[model samples]
Target chain A: MTDLIERPSTEAVPGHGAPTHGDDDHAHGGDHEHHGPSGILKWLTSTDHKVIGINYTVTSIVMMVIGGAFAEVIRAQLVSPTNTLVTFQQYNQLFTMHGSVMIYLFVGPFAFAGLANYLVPLQVGAPDMAFPRLNALSYWLYLSGSITMLLGFFVTGGPAAFGWVGYAPLTSAINAPGAGPDLWIGALMLTGFSAIFSGVNLIATIFYLRAPGMTLFRMPIFTWNMLVTGILILLAFPVLTAGLVMLYCDRHFGTHIFEVQGGGVPLLWQHIFWFWGHPEVYILALPFFGMVTEVIPTFSRKPLFGYKGMVFATLTIAALSLGVWAHHMFTTGAVLLPFFSIMSLLIAVPTGIKIFNWIGTMWGGNLVFSTAMLMAIGFVVTFLIGGITGIYLASPPLDFFTHDTYFVIAHFHSVVMALTLGAFAGIYFWFPKITGKMLHEGWGKAQFWLLFIGTQVFTVPLYIVGLHGMPRRMAVYPNNPSWQNLNEWSSVGALMIGISTLLFVVNVIQAYRKPIPAGDNPWDASTLEWFTSSPPPHHNFVSLPPIRSERPVWDYNHPDAPALAHGHHETATPPAAPAEQEAHA
Target chain B: MKQESVILLLLGVFFGFIGVVYWGWGHEDGGGIMLLGAFLLGMLPGFYYLWWYRKSGGNRPEDRDDATVADGAGVVDAFPSTSIWPFVLGSGCFFIVLALTFGTWLLVPGVGLLLSALIGATAESRRGGNV
Candidate 1:
């Protein structure tokens, strides 16, 4: 059978799905190097997007464990009244590295690199990523950047404790001097470059690539989300790279880019950082948005609700997310409250559309409560709460009370942590397809519940303590009876979140230990990705299948519907009729 | 012969234009910009020709000319048997990551992997006498 499959002349295979000009125009175009070794060699040297995707997932999981450990240490220190478990310096380092690692090292890269690596080419109907060698380089650069930043901890004076934002003066050599911030800046600069190059590659691929009849309008929601995400990276990362360069200059050289004593503007740093930082927020979340599009449609057993609107909303969010960066600096006292407030509130308009669309998608559908769906739903609820509190933070009046408090922590953590959960949800959902094996479902679900409850318990009370004038990044609250109880509750919640993380780890290990065979289209997804074998071939498709709609695989697998008018049809039978009938009926 | 080289040439021209704009800004430290510009100017037409042959509706024989693959090179499509360059590159990456994190000792292995891969690739490709 395999030989029969391989017997077709290469000329017979249709190439990229560009609008077929004539009979002779559709011969296969791409030529890639194929290598051997079924086991370790495949993983070690493979340029296949699927292999690269697994590498991303494995690396991200490792970082998450490391990030979560940092969280636990922070929680343990905060559990009791005035517990000097860790020194003040140590506590500062913990939260700062925790924030930086989780944001840059874990969520940001994992969301884009992991899902985009696996899904972008499949969604766009390409054989593989546009630049396969470049794709490998992105992964390597990311791993390199992550390791460099982490290595800062082992260096003298520990990692930069100036918070992930690395606010000036605090990060400046005059106030807090060390090799720590240098490592942080250098690592981020490297990671930023990785993201920029990958973004360029993805953008060029999606635009120039795609199978025939796969019009922009007909593209899947996940692909659209990534398209917008790629644009965001191009625009946002350069500003960050510039900012990092200026920062490097200030730190290493005697440049006064942000040096207060040297007549440098601290707020300039804020402008540049947040310009990238705010978009960084969406860069982190948009992939989750993309994943939600995938999960919600599959679990709800419907095509995405308002697909075009969701795409528009995603772009809107990406654009608006850029303008609202200053809202993060409301506490900095130099920002214009009215302008930032308006922009921040305006963001909710597009965001509201997204929430409604997700809910609309699930409404009156089968609504399978898989680990993926739970996480998507979790994203909506958590992000909604995060968004609402964000509006409060946007207001100068409300922010005056909550500024630098645990309230701010609760707000951002809700959004970013929700992103982490959503990413994990995607990893679990797609793990079977990518690995050609099933992750332990029982462990997966248990992990989900733990994180859900843990997030609520741990982060919600930070709001209360925040309102009671308790600041963030504080090692110990000195004799504040009012703050003690809520802090303890938060600690307990943190512990649960930690346990949930362990469950996920256990699930990953167990699944790898005895891999379950997941056949092609395990979820019965309608998109083109599911049409191929589990862990798709290095060159994605063999014969370019005829795609008439967004859901080509579904169209093909359905038995009832007539085949679309496409030349170079390989299979004699119309295999898609049954699924089409079932869907319509 | 491949599309990538042509694309790179086109990129060179476009980037050269950018270098021109930077040079016009009269920044004295524009040597880097001008050098990049010179490189790009030298590469444009060659790239344009290559892209025309591969992608554009070109006047060429069907069999002898490069035949464009379908949307994806569909399932079971054959190509050159796998090469070891990617693994060598991966090894280079592992060492680079280690060197970044641990110390300079790891840099030696990374450089070694990279050089060996480069040399090995160059030698093997030359065996086909393509280069």
Candidate 2:
């Protein structure tokens, strides 16, 4: 690696001669890596981060559709008291697959593997990830894991139906006794290993590959969130892998780590699972939080408020999250209840700080209500509700009462809603940069409203019925008009949610079909990504803008902006050299 | 070495402090040991970055306040061309997974593909061509 870098393989463009950075010895960017095979072979064998990112993303979208299909079927079964849309056994499999596919394959990978793979190197001005081939391997491994999981349905006894948690002796060989649960375990182990490697790749990129003058603090908030997310993945995934290994041994190798008959403790499973599970929540969230941070500043036409505070707050939230896993186990009675509860409640402090930071960025600014911006606003509102409910659930008494009820379902769904909206905002915001084509703004808004309203319609009744003592994972129920009516409304909302995703599918197709080319910097965004060409060239940059502050692109464009005018650089302490000043001017 | 180490150190301290407290009070050695393991996990990486920072003398262009953008410009590493090693590795992992569903006899080919992929990838990286 050092030999290749020190070799200085500089190549020149034919006619486009721009000032290529400071030293003439430097290699030109964006002039290499156009050689290789084409078509499907290219996609499978390519080492390009952007191609791998698109692979991760497109595959995740398909998985989401699959998970959502499971959801729709499950909802149809629950829509009426006497409905037999699916057998109880089928319902078990449906919800099981739904939760597994959505959490593992869809949300977490969409951010950690998909968007991060595409954006990190571009935003950092690096030629590629620190380990390009390893990056390719991570994507393929992820695909294999996804395929293994989906193949469970075709196995002899149907897919694993012990819920996504795959809790305890219920998942042991004595009970499950088939290849389905074993396949699920194997699939999860593969995915978990894939995530661990991705963490190594991303963290190395951020640490070793920043452009000149882009200090750790000068890196954008999106990259910062990704950095923290990378660490959490490293810290959390290995434990999950360990637990899965123990369970796999119990099932296949006759080890009795989780079998009650062998004097194994079942609660140990909860301890191991939630240890990874709680941190997994932040793994899914922090990247979307990064998205919201990016979008609000761009559309509000202001800098992110408390940039340093947001960074520290992200760290604080992660550290607190690692200690709060027992909050999920308060109903189980085998945890240090007070310690975990207090730690769980303490996460609210940093999260609340983040909320205020978004609102502060939008306050008194020229806020543009674009589809992306509207989604950011929507994220703030919905995520706040999720946060409040989370606080309620942190208390042992409340959590004990709401442990398996729709109330807990409503709370988490609100959070998923917020992050999904945040992801939608990121997609619309960066679609231009990814494909060099503008998504239809009208259709984008149409989809956003459908999703937002659908979430409320679906979850509000869930909270109401949960308060009225409705439980979750109940495939059949006695006829009661009130619960029946509320569930019907929720079912309608589920249909609306399904329609919205389909609309998004249509919007993506139309955008590609009748292409409206979006010029670079369509939103006049502050981040480094906006400084590059749309659907950036293979190596991602021609020449990077001079980095003097967190908002390097903004500093380069608005030379007289107050932030730069007052000399607010995070990296350099000395006054700018004359040529440097002249160049920036 | 850098601010990241400091961040990791802070996490380690938080986990380590709670770990001692939990063991002192809770009396169940299992959970406390897990907390200690977490502390060690955070600290090991923290110390590694710190070590690299010191060994490199902490004079990286990124750390230089007055460094020009071009000082950091260049191809950071050689991005290799297309190869089938990742695909080979994937198939190896897939077969290992399948070995669980089918009989244990499949482990032979599964482990075989995995070892071949490892050796093949190492050779491919050191030399040129598919090997």
Candidate 3:
């Protein structure tokens, strides 16, 4: 193992030229295996971070559709006050599985692991992750876990129906008998391992693999977010892993950890789960914050406003997120309500600082409302609304009324929905760089509008009905008749979101079929990623510009007015000749 | 990095002050403990970064604006070419989890696969095999 760690193999310098190292028999010193491996095996055994990233993205999309299908069934059942669409058992399974798949499989993995895997290495100007083999292992573990979780649907008693939270006593063996919840527990444990592995890999890569000139302060905002996210995952995931193990032991080994009759405390599960759960919320959303941070600066054609403030705000949010987890347990009566309430409210301050920084970034710049920028701006608006609504819930007195109601549903859904928008914005902005193909702007805009308008239409009524005393997760509601209209309106909104998602699928397909090459730096952005080729080669870059500031390319473009000049270590080597400059350009 | 550390340290102090105020006001149960936790957590990264900044002479490559892509050209970073251990490890985990439902007997192979996968992933590159 030490020998493997110390192996002196040839490294490939891609993008500039072909294999220059003559010692190795393998093409590109085995680093460029993506060029060699073909067909399905390439995808399965390939250790390439890019391939694993693509695999994660595709799988998460499919999971999103499956989760969305479950959601549609939920909406269909709730279209009217009567329970005509499905029985209570089936409805319970639908909502539970929907929430589980969307949170664990789709949103969290897609944003943190999937997108981060692809972009982080590129953004940091590294050939691959610090641990490529471990990267592959993480992806495979995620797939295995996702598959295991989904397999519960085929079980005799159906999938776990104890809510996505999987609160205990309810999820204990005596109460929820079957392989369904067991599979859920097992799946969560596996995915928990996957997340921890990815977290370690990302933190290592970002910390150690940065280019020579890319300092900690100069790292991209997206990379900063990923860094903090990696820390949060490392800190928080173990609690969930422990919780899953305890639950598994309770279910299979009869340890009765949550069995109140057996001297167990059900609230223990809540404490453990929410300890990870609230951070998991930020885990899912912080990447989007990073995405918006990138998009706003690029389209606004300005360096990020309060760059130092944004970084500190992100770190602050991460730290505060840990202490505020009990906010979710505000109504449980077992929690210290005042402590949780104040912490929850205080966490909002750093988040508000971030929003202000974003708006300040766009305040006095050439703001271009491209599809990506529009989605990002949309994220800012919707996420702010979500954040504000959250503050209302932070008050324990207010939470008492809103707990388990559609109001609670409205708050989180708004945040996650905004996250979805930000994810879409990131996809649009980076699609050109990833695939070297630009999506059709008209179709992209159409899809965005449909989603934006539809999301509002869908969630606004939910808030209204919730305020009107409608409870969530109900298979059927009372024949209040007035609640029926709002529910139906929300159902219509769900349909629009569905249609818009399909349009997005079509847009991706259509764009891929007719490829238009997006030149390097199509957006002329300032980040290191823009300095490389669109659809960068195996090793990502041939040569990187001297990173003197956060935006190296910006400095390259404006040599006279460089962003920062102090502390730059100028090598004795002469500047590039005019001809060389032209060639590089 | 120093600037960020200072800002975070200040924020930590502010939150700590809030905790003290809350405690004084007799809302100390959840509020004071949580606020204090937040303050301590905040100070952790702040001090860590401050240490790093001092240790590294406060110089960062990202702080240089005169660099170009050509300056970055060199031997690319090393990466493993191909390996089957990740697959083995994933399958091992899947089976181990699956064994919870089917039978405990599958755990033997699961453990075997896991151990072997770990060995393979760690030692493959040593033999000049795929990375």
User: What lDDT does the true structure give each of the candidates?
Assistant: 0.70, 0.82, 0.79
Q: Which 10 consecutive residues of model 2 chain A have the lowest summed lDDT?
A: A572-581
Ranking by lDDT: 2, 3, 1
Q: For residues A1-585, write the lDDT of model 2, one tens digit per residue.
A: 112332122222312333243233343643443557799888877777889889999998899999999989988999998788888878898989999999999999999989999998888877677777788788878898899898988988898988998899789887887888988988898889889888988998898888777788888888999999999998899989999999999988888888888888888888889889999999999999998899998877777888888998999998888888878888877788888888899999999999999998888677667788888888899899889999999999989888999999889989998888898998988888898888887888899899989988988898888888888999987799999999999988889999999999999999889887876767767788777777776667656666777887766666556564222222212222223112212
Instruction: Candidate 2: list runs displaced more than 4 Å.
Output: A1-33, A564-585, B128-131
Candidate 1 lDDT over B69-95, as tens digits, reads 332233333222234664575467657
Q: Order of all candidates by DockQ, from best down to worst?
A: 2, 3, 1
Best by TM-score: 2
Give the candidate number with the greatest DockQ. Answer: 2
Model 3 chain B poorest 10 in a row by lDDT: B61-70
Runs in model 1 deviating more than 4 A are A1-34, A37-44, A559-585, B1-131
Chain B TM-score in each of the candidates: 0.43, 0.84, 0.57
- After superposition on all C-alphas, the RMSD of every candidate to the true structure, in Å, is 8.5, 5.3, 6.2
Interface RMSD of 2: 4.4
Alpha carbon lDDT at A245, candidate 2 = 91
Provide the DockQ value for model 3. Answer: 0.28
Q: Flag clash pairs in model 2.
A: A572-B65
Structural similarity to truth (TM-score) of each candidate: 0.79, 0.93, 0.87
